[model samples]
Target: MSRFAPNRYRGKLIIVEGIDGSGKSTQLSLLSQWLRSQRLAVSFSEWNSSDMVKGTTRRGKKKQMFTPTTFSLIHATDFADRHERYILPMLKAGAVVCADRYAYTAFARDVARGVSRAWVRNLYSMAIKPNLAFYFRVPLDVALDRILGGRAALKYYEAGMDLDLSQNIVESFRIFQSRILEEYEAMSGEMGFHVIDATQSIETQQQQMRQIVMDRIGAALENDILRSPLEIDRAG
Candidate 1:
């Protein structure tokens, strides 16, 4: 399948991408709240959260049954389910859809796990191109510290133990994430990602994100009014 062009849907799609602990999720949540505060219809979608495949993915992870190929396929299934059910419908309804992660996650992680980059991109060719895609770039060590500081132990796949990168989970995580980071850097230009320095204060990052988003989509959203039934009836 060829790459799908940006949709002509009434809504806008905004997505964030980064390694785990890069605080992309937090920034996305803030952006969503700001959009809603502005009276725009907003919806949120998260990566790998599709109920259709969540249980299966959990079991696969528990049993450590996924190779690089199987891992890629499973995530693709999750994305497809969300795209059709949650993302597409909300977009068609003129909602600002905020995604915590998108195809870029698979592109970086799957390739880091030894899956072919071309195949991974082809798997997600049907995805709608986002109006704004933010890539939160943080140093690997900083990301590691943030995640580990909040957790007791890293999960098997989360730390990239499957690839035998290191005996120690922490070391393996560093190595694996570094590979993913390299892929993200290479893709930043190719994918037209607006890269943000994530080590700044949270307030600073959020301020920058808000300014960028407003600059990009403010004109389109400014006049988008959601009328109540009474208002609609009066107009009619």
Candidate 2:
């Protein structure tokens, strides 16, 4: 059990996840706006956004300087910083917390990079679970096509270039993303991810996600009346 789990929490931690082009970031941004429109206190966090490790991680990937093990450890450090600086503070304050990607990114991406799944899980065991976790599932080809269409070029890390899996970056992204998807699917059952079909229209997906968020807020509050924060009563 996590040391932080002993204390009662009033805030809800919601996480959205998927491959690079799965539209989770976009949705999370919109969700934050919608939550605020309802006058809820919302705090948003993104993967690798920690100031403590971002510069080092960026420089490493830019120079192709990190091995898989190094990359995994750096990400774990980044997440640990996030947990301390943003997640823990906001949740304890009873704010509704939204994360673009959480520790599961490490679980899937790190394991996909050949790191041990058990090791990665243990690395994140100290963290508290999210009140709601969303996994957007899109086909590999669809995700890559969406990515390639808008971007001028894929970043080396994004393409899994460090892994040396393929001479072609496009093919490499396909294979790498497929592995991540497999890991996420395997984890969804155990981790309680509410799977969202990414093939759906943006409006439809957003609507569904908001509904789930509303339902979860209700469930969490019902579980403990003292846990209500940034309340969104249905009648309101």
Candidate 3:
């Protein structure tokens, strides 16, 4: 399993998803580094990464008026631009692309904010599905504690909001978390959905994540690796 056989997938589109403070970014970096060490050509991407999306997030944060659905829409646009301009092309070229966040974030967060699950799904209906999606699972309290301890100020939906809204969001997130976990679990039953424990120490989590990536990209882990497939063609 050094590298995928040329016929395996057009390229590998790996998406790491989770709630805030889920340590996804750290693990994503570690996994990407490991892939590079194996001589695989890997590129990294993130949501709200483009200038337009970043500006939207900033303006919304400043105004503190954007709803969950508004935020979700912005993120969806970001992904559309990202996929059309970056991801799809890379996959076509047979390159491994790892995304820091994906539509699942929108699906979860928006639903927590009261957006219908159908609405969220419909918004991302055209987005590309990931070859492997890693959900970092952690306790709600632990994640909130980490956020509170961090230095960053709250953004839009998080800032200057009443306790009612905040509390509603929190409770909603709990439900959203459970539902998304179930969804991921179901998908995993059918395909590749790897759930990583987000409660572990940073070093331990990174090592575990790295090992998972190495295993999935096994054999392809050697020198002069070719591009991995993005979509698994079962028909062939």
**Considering lDDT, where higher is better, how would the candidates rank from best to worst?**
1, 2, 3
For residue 75, what is the lDDT in candidate 3?
A: 82
Clashes of each: 0, 0, 15
Q: For each candidate, give its TM-score against the true structure.
A: 0.93, 0.89, 0.75
lDDT of 1 by residue, 52-81 (tens): 999999999999989999999999999999
Per-residue alpha-carbon lDDT of candidate 3 for residues 1-236, written as tens digits (9 for 90 to 100): 01212324466788888767678888889888877765677888887797668887787767766766677788888878887789877776667889998777776566656678677778777767776788888776787678658856553354324223334555644444555555544444343458788998988888877777667755544533454546578899
Q: Model 1, residue 55: what's the lDDT?
A: 96
Q: What is the overall TM-score of model 3 with all chains considered together?
A: 0.75
Residue 2 in model 3: shift from native, Å? 29
Evaluate all candidate structures by whole-model CA lDDT and list the values in order: 0.90, 0.83, 0.69
Residue runs of model 3 more than 4 Å from their true location after superposition: 1-9, 159-192, 219-236
Better of 1 and 2 by lDDT: 1
Candidate 1 RMSD computed on C-alpha atoms after optimal superposition onto the true structure: 3.5
* Angstrom error at residue 143, model 2: 0.8
C-alpha displacement of 127 in model 2, angstroms?
1.0
Ten contiguous residues with the weakest lDDT in model 2: 220-229
